[model samples]
Target: MHVVVNAATSADGKLSSRRREQIAISGEKDFARVDRLRADSDAVVVGVGTVLADDPSLTVKDEQLCERRREQGDPEQPARIVVDSTGRTPTDAAIVDDAASTYVCLSEAAPVDRRMDLADRAELVTAGEDRVDLLRAFAALEAAGLERIMVEGGGELIFSLFEAGLVDELRVFVGPTVIGGRDAPTLADGDGFVAEFPTLTLESLERVDDGALLIWRADG
Candidate 1:
């Protein structure tokens, strides 16, 4: 399966404020651009942190796009997957709606009540012992027939996937604003690499409004 990471960040690379609040980094044009990417993919994945912060609908909003997918004999909407180790995504979250198939990946340590509560709303997959194992989750997603996956993130999840060398491409929409804070979230968080780190090759650049959209590929 092909794994792609997508994010919109500030000029200083912060995804959001220090307290993890959601910020509007992308403009309307960028939103449409990302919606197109979502419409083109087989599945869209995000961490639970994003869910709690943004409460995203996680579906393609354009009716024309949905019609096009239908005409092509594809699902009207791509499957939604959440890497939620603790099963913290509320059962009533937008992702639990019937707009698309929802899959919640969890660790063995996920709460039983939460798991049971979500059973009817989403497909629960145990992927790791204590945290959601991205590799295992990817394999399960592939097995479920989602080969082209897009990851829309909230820092920690992006870091884990990229650090695992699983991302084939990273598409970042850099906005003009800067909200700098020592505890602010960046593109790749967690215990970042110290040596022998992975590198990215700039693949493309396109300016939009006051910012630019950059695409980088994982170095071979």
Candidate 2:
């Protein structure tokens, strides 16, 4: 299965501020396109911050969009997964409430008791020491029969996967806004990880509506 990173960025290249604020907000077309991408994927993966900030339903909406999904071979819906190293995923988060299937990846640092609680609502998986492991998580999802894994990330998650070379493709939607936040984050791995995507290369770039969507492929 190919792991795909799909995210929206501002014209200025900021995902969100350090305080976890929204920037580079997408227009209706981009928003709908994102949803369509979710629908077309076998699973939708996101970081814990996005869950807390966006509270996205992760389900394909819009009558026309839903119809298009059916044409694309997408059935009911795709599974939703969240990477929460501390097992900090809110029990009442909409992703858990709405997704037909959900998985929460917690780190070994989390207490065994907490794992039980998370497992009751969503399947609990362990990765890394105190941070989620991008390679392990993606491999597990791939083993579970997900051929197309879509990552909708907060900064840290995106950076980790890219740096680890787990990302097989990248689809960036560039919006027409510059929300300048000094603390805004664009994926951070606090342990000072160096990016080593030595074989990844861009495949194509196209202007989609109000913004440009850049596509890249995992190269050998």
**Residue 64 lDDT, candidate 2, scale 0-100:** 77
Please give the TM-score that candidate 1 achieves against the real structure: 0.97
lDDT of 2 by residue, 1-220 (tens): 7788888888877787666755546777788888878777888888888898978767767667667766877656788889899877777888887446888888888777778777778977787897887678767767778788899887778777767777788788887777676667653333445454345577888887778888878673
Clash count list over all predictions: 0, 5
Give all candidate RMSDs, comma-separated.
1.0, 2.6
**10 residues in a row with least lDDT, candidate 1:** 157-166
* Model 2, residue 69: C-alpha shift (Å): 5.9
Candidate 2 clashes between residue pairs 3 or more apart in a chain or in different chains: 17-184, 18-183, 18-184, 155-187, 156-187
| Candidate 1 per-residue lDDT over residues 15-123, each given as its tens digit | 9999888888888999999999999999999999999988988899999999999999999999999999999999989998999999999999998999999898999
How far off is residue 44 in model 2, in Å?
0.5
CA-lDDT, candidates in order: 0.92, 0.77
Off by over 4 Å in 2: 63-75, 187-200
